[model samples]
Target: MKFQRIGEHGAERPIVVDGEIAYDLAPLTGDIDGDFLASGGIEATALALARKRLSPITIEGLRVGAPIARPQAVWCVGLNYAAHAKESGAPLPDAPVLFFKTPNTVIGPFDDVLIPRGSAKTDWEVELAVVIGRRARYLDSVDEAMDHIAGYTISNDVSERAFQLEQSGGQWSKGKCCETFNPLGPALVPRDELDPGNLRLRSFVNGESRQDSSTADLIFDVAYVVWHLSQYAVLEPGDVVNTGTPEGVALSGRFPYLRAGDVVELEIEGIGSIRQTCRNAG
Candidate 1:
């Protein structure tokens, strides 16, 4: 089942999408959060649907929020895609290069992306975000790592190259944490509904294609990423792991960086799509 949060910002209610119909799950759960997922919210939601306990709600013109309320941490993998790594002038990493985007970067998929003050290198990255369902620590193998994942969602790993490279002394997080940097989700598609390893994910800026790539290009893959991460830090339910972005980003110097009034659209096969408009930050 595909799950989503829809309503005004900060007041979204949970719902499950079955085809074109959206059934409100607010009667069963207030919001889809870390606590909800840890307590088997997926299973409970399925049961609720099967029992015909939810009412179909009209979602016309309503906003979509991040599928889960707020993640514990928005962990990211740098250079996980071969072409993306090459485009960014890095060699294929033998192990995942990890980074963090503060939880505050989480915003609805349709929200406006802010071009931070004095910014000039704002860019976009289309990524498949893995949402962890179960606690993971020291996983023995990649298969074990897959068991901890709840589902997948689309995340535009928006960045600013100058802040990330030129001014940061080489740290990437400085450019990654601006407001609305991570536009996530039209839905959180369960693992059973789609193949995490093979999916077509892409990005379009102002109706012109910028990045068109697939998860199949990922050098680390999803399972290994989670397993490798578990070897050090603990991953909890509702924690989002941005597996990495495929090539076609603005940072390649092939395309101009984003500016105010530009619209960015991100899509991942099976998961869903997100449309964000760029705006200048005051």
Candidate 2:
């Protein structure tokens, strides 16, 4: 099943997506958050639909927010794609390179992306984001890791090169945490609805294709990433994991950095698409 939250930025209402029709789910659940997913949110939504308990509502002009309510954390894996690593001139890591983007970076799929103050090399990364459905701590195996995922979403891991590489002492989080850096979803699609491992994801800037690749190229697939991270930290429900991106980012020095008014669109097959316009920070 697919789920979405539509309305103004902090005032979104949860709804279930059935093709182009959207059914309001507020009558059954408050919001699709960690507690809801961990305590049978999917099952509850299914039952509500089967019993014909929801009313289809119109979302003609409302904004679509990230599907899950603010996640506890937004974790990211870097250099997981061999070509992407090569493009960035970095060696392939032996394990998933983990990083964190504070939850504040999360923004609606179509929201405007702000180029942070003094930024010169803001870039885009199209990645498959994994939404955890259950707490995962020291997961026993890849199968166990897979079981903990609730669904998938598309994420544009917007970044700044100078802050990430030059001025911040090599800490990627410095560039990753700017407000609106992580534009996350149109919907959270249940794992059963699609296979996250084989989807094709791409990024475009101002209508020009920049990155084009598939999840099949991931060095550490979704299951292994969850299993690997769980050994060191507890991954709670509603946590977001950006699996990694493939090649063709602006950081390769092939394309220019984003500027105010640049439009960036990120799409991942099955999950959905996100289109964000870059603007200067006020």
Candidate 3:
């Protein structure tokens, strides 16, 4: 089942839409998560509610907001895809390469991605974001790990290569934490609705195709990634993990980085598409 946060221009609310029956979720509850993944989260409770009722609000009347209002944390994996690793000129780490992008970077779909000032190397990475449902710790197996996921969404891991490598002690966050860099949600689709291994991911700039690939190319798939990350950190509700991107980002291209006025669009087979316009900070 698919769900989204909806509303008119100024007021945004959540609604459960299963087929044609749209339920006014805001009248019943607050956010999508609570104790478990679905009971109060994006995965089940809302979906279960969506399939049953039709307390419809104007479908196109309100504005849409990020599926998850304020994510607990936005985590990212670098070089998880073989082609991406090669393009970025980094050797694939034996273990997942992790980084942090403060949750503040999270923004709604279609918002403009600001190219931070002095950012001479802004890059784009179209990644599949995994939303956690249950709080997990020391997960025993990949199968068990997979069970902890709530759903998925499309994310653009907008980056600034110069900050990452040259100015900031080689910290990934330096290049990754530019404001308006992370554009999330047209909507968050349940994991059951999407077969992760088979989905196709594509990115375009100003209508020109740049990155094109499949999750099938991920050297480390979703399940293993969750299982692996859990060994060290406690995975909490609303924590978002950006599974990583395929090749063809500007940093890895045979060209100068993004300047300004470039628009990026990313599509995943069933997860919906995300379009972001780039504007200079000046």
The TM-scores, one per candidate, come to 0.98, 0.98, 0.92
Cα lDDT tens digits, model 3, 170-191, are: 5779888888888887777877
Write down the lDDT that model 3 would get. 0.80
Off by over 4 Å in 2: none
- Error in Å for residue 156 of model 2: 0.6
Ranking by TM-score: 2, 1, 3
Q: Over all chains combined, what TM-score does candidate 1 have? A: 0.98
| Error at 162, model 3, angstroms | 0.5
What ranges in model 1 sit over 4 Å off?
Answer: none
In candidate 3, the residue pairs with backbone N, CA or C atoms under 3 Å apart (3 or more residues apart, or in different chains) clash, namely 7-62, 7-63, 8-61, 8-62, 8-63, 32-40, 32-41, 33-40, 33-41, 38-45
Model 1: worst 10 consecutive residues (lDDT sum): 32-41
Clashes of each: 0, 0, 10
Clashes of 1: 0
The collision pairs in model 1 are none
Where does the lowest 10-residue lDDT sum fall in candidate 3? 34-43
